[model samples]
Target: MSKVLYIKANAKPEGESKTFRIADKFMEAYKKHHPQDEIVTLDLYKEDIHFLTVEDVMVHMSNEVEEKENPMKRYALQFKSADKYIFAEPMWNLGIPAILKAYIDYVSIPNITFKYSENGPIGLCQGKKALNITTSGGDYTEGMAAEWDLCDKYLKTIMGLFGIFDYTTIRASNLDVIGMDVEAIVNKAIEEAEELAKTF
Candidate 1:
């Protein structure tokens, strides 16, 4: 059975957050489809994820530090070990949450997720797949507003650096738009998510 890492980067709880509403349904469907697979959930809000400090940098750079003793290495190892990844978050100010960025910093270590070579940086975690579930108050799918969608683009780019090219995104947009049927939009995305989970 493959190990799947489900990372939650939203501050809002279930039922209230649009991102969670869709992601939770996807997780439920995914579990039914892959009963034997192991799914590990990492809740960023509940976890003690912090910004990378000088000590964190030193731990990885120093040859004297034991791999087991390095706290940051644990995150990198966990990320490298996962066969699949699911990221759930809501777009905030055209980007992802700061805590989520912090989580990425911990997992993205040279020689772990990637390594620099003569051809420049090369990703180590090849053959891994990723699914990103995102929600935005304003529509970021098309038209002029699409340029402002930094959240999805950023995630895809970063994941690519880790050699995960098989990436998919399920987005629920325009939830806060006035006079729109918010429930219908979200429900539709949830339905799509459920279907994707079957083959994901």
Candidate 2:
């Protein structure tokens, strides 16, 4: 069975978060479709992920730091071993949450998730797939506002850096837009998530 890492980046709890609501449907459908697959949920807020410090960077740069001795190695190891990834978050100030970014940094270690090459940095974690489920108050998928969207764009770019090219994003947008039917929009995203989970 495959290993799926479900990374929850929102500060809000599962019940209050719209992003989680959609992800919940996806998880339910995904479980139904892939019962044998192991799903591991990493809740960023609850995990209290911290930003990398100077010592952390030094440890990563030094080959002398053993995997077991490094405080942050577990995150990278967990991330590297996963066959699939699910990122669920809400758009905050046109980007992702601070904890989520910190968690990404924690797992993006050289030689573990990537390595240096003569040409450039080559990702070590290949043959992996990722799905990004995000919610935004404003619509960022089209028109001029799309330029302000850094959440999905950044995640896709980072995933590619890790050699995960088969990345998909399911965005729930315009939920807070005035005069729009919020429930309808969310329900539509939930349906999309459910369908995608069937084949994901």
Instruction: Please give the RMSD to the true structure for each candidate, in Å.
Output: 1.5, 1.2
Tens-place lDDT digits, model 2, residues 1-200 = 99999999987886999999999899999999999999999998888468788998986786652475565777888899999999999999999998989998888888888888898889878999999999999999888899999999999999888889999999989988899998998999999999999999
The per-residue C-alpha lDDT of model 2 at residue 1 equals: 92
Query: What's the distance in Å from true for residue 98, model 1?
Result: 0.5
lDDT of 1 at 178: 99
Off by over 4 Å in 2: 64-66
Instruction: State the RMSD for candidate 1.
Output: 1.5
Enumerate clash totals for all models, in the order shown: 0, 0
